[model samples]
Target: MMLIKRIAVALALWFTAGMTPLKAETTLLFNVFVPRSNNFHEVTAQWAEEVKAATNGEVTIQFTAGNMAPPPEQLEAVKSGVFDIAFIANIFLKNKAPLLQATMLPWLVDKSENASIALWRVYKKHIEPKAPFPDAHLLTLFHWEGGQLASITDTKINDIKELKSRKMWALPGPPADLLKTLGMSPVATPAVQVGEMVSRKIVSGYMGIAPEIARDFKAGPYTKTITWFPRSVTSTSFSVFMNQEKWNTLSDKNKEAIMSVSGEHFAAMAGAASNKEMQAALDEMKKNGVEIVPANPDFYKKMQAAAQPQFDAMRKEGERLGVNVDAMLEDFIKESESIK
Candidate 1:
């Protein structure tokens, strides 16, 4: 009787020990560089909630808003494990991620959602094997709605000739280069400085930003007309990535859960949110008496012709990076168009 009782007690103890949870919960620290009100930040918070639910509480995210590092330094912070996750603007990675520059070419994609998903697809198919960010695990890629041309002047840009010698603020990289090629004295400055520049009359107009950005940055009030392009003059691309060590700490199940809500799904979510915000901003701009007009058809043709060199430059650089630039570009356009 004594032996039987001892055996039963040992069995119970073993069973209870075996049934106990094997892993403690994991909480990842996310550093948000952009303002909390920004669409990317809002969507990231939503993504965190989705990750927690998807992992059944095994994994969670905590956000520390405000810049932990400058925009250009965010990737290095994650690489060194200062933060578990970050959304990095591709412009900052120009040297390390040359292939991704393809996303920034002018007039390539019309809609944000389509462009975002297409970016992810192309990255996976062409850029992934190249291992662009070996130190960080990429979660997703995304772009904002197409950027438009807005000027403080009342006259719409009806002729390409009008742009000659005109001073304008342009987003850095290809957009700025394109503006320069068109004979504009382009100031390639950060978006945060745009409002002050505009108010001080530092530039006559700006290009390569969505409507929401112009509004949020207080540049809309001084603007007289926004020239809508059938496709954007240029668009910015962003990447959400995790520290490699932090990612490796996650169990396979939790990793799968995180990725399930990432990639194309996350891109689409961010893009859709951006589209909503953009439309609202445009509406507000109209209500505030800003005129929104389409680019003149002849001007559009000339602009496209000018953009050819940009496309060529990107292809040349992509080829140097060993990417099948032609095929990749073709795929991206096809996928983007097919999404709608």
Candidate 2:
């Protein structure tokens, strides 16, 4: 009887061992709104690869680009578990994440990598608790170096005055405000439509990245001039968001794996890619005889002056949102400058 009992137990243990492991593999769904060549899309792919390698394939990410969801709808989709992961551009969530606007106040950081680090630090410290990512877990924050004005018109945007007479395309939030303050009529146009709008005479020019402009507007055909500016002019803020429920279910080992490649590191990676893409587009513009015009210091000073009130308003809004705007601004800039 003893020999039979021992043999039965050994058999059961051996069979169960082969049938099940302790951890189930997980593959997360990553949603992107742009094409593979797009900077953000490229970064997302890298992030997924890093996470998978770090986890030894315990976890993986399946990317579904092609506008799986629009920016405005991303917040709710993430919270509702429509996507396990998504990137939310801050511009689309003004009412939802009002406090985050502080980091985006133009002219804060000079480089995309700098802005990316600053945003990650600030969000973790100040905005995460009060900000509305609505049922999502904040992963990382990043931004491009800065955006500039590009025109298809015969006249160049050498100064604010040139912008005044032009019907300029603007996105929501600070970009629209900056142009309006500088005396340009801000026409709210979807990025996909910028090329068509310019061709049809709906807008004289636009304030965005050269890469984005070339992608949508085929700048070589329509753009005769490109304008560059500093942080005081414009930048974009984007955050990596995951459904809270999904995040909670991740094992500690897997959590660490995902986060291992996130934060400031991810920010720098994405920002650098964006900067490279911008430079490439500018080079193409030059080859096509599109005049690449650097905004003179005179123009910069004028824009800084014109942009002051907008900054003030952003600070006031920050205060109303219960954050100490002045102090946050100083800290944000300090963190940005402190990063090499």
Could you say which candidate leads in TM-score? 1
Q: Could you tell me every candidate's TM-score relative to the true structure?
A: 0.92, 0.87
**Which parts of model 2 are misplaced by more than 4 Å?**
1-22, 129-133
lDDT of 2 at 84: 86
- In order, candidate lDDTs are 0.87, 0.75
lDDT for each residue of candidate 2 in 1-340, tens digit (9 for 90 to 100): 9999999999999999899667578888878876666778778888988998988888899976456677778878878777788887777877777766666666665777877887787777776655545568877878875666788887888876677878888765677777777666687766666677778888888775445545545545788887766553567778788888888998998898889898888988988887787678767777878887778889878877776887788777777767777777787889878878
Worst 10 residues of 2 by lDDT: 208-217
Residue pairs clashing, model 2: 107-231, 107-232, 112-145, 195-217
Predicted candidate 1 versus true structure: per-residue lDDT over 72-98, tens digit per residue: 888899999888999888888888887
Q: Any idea what lDDT model 2 has?
A: 0.75
Give me the displacement of residue 245 in model 2, in angstroms: 1.1
Clashing pairs in 1: none
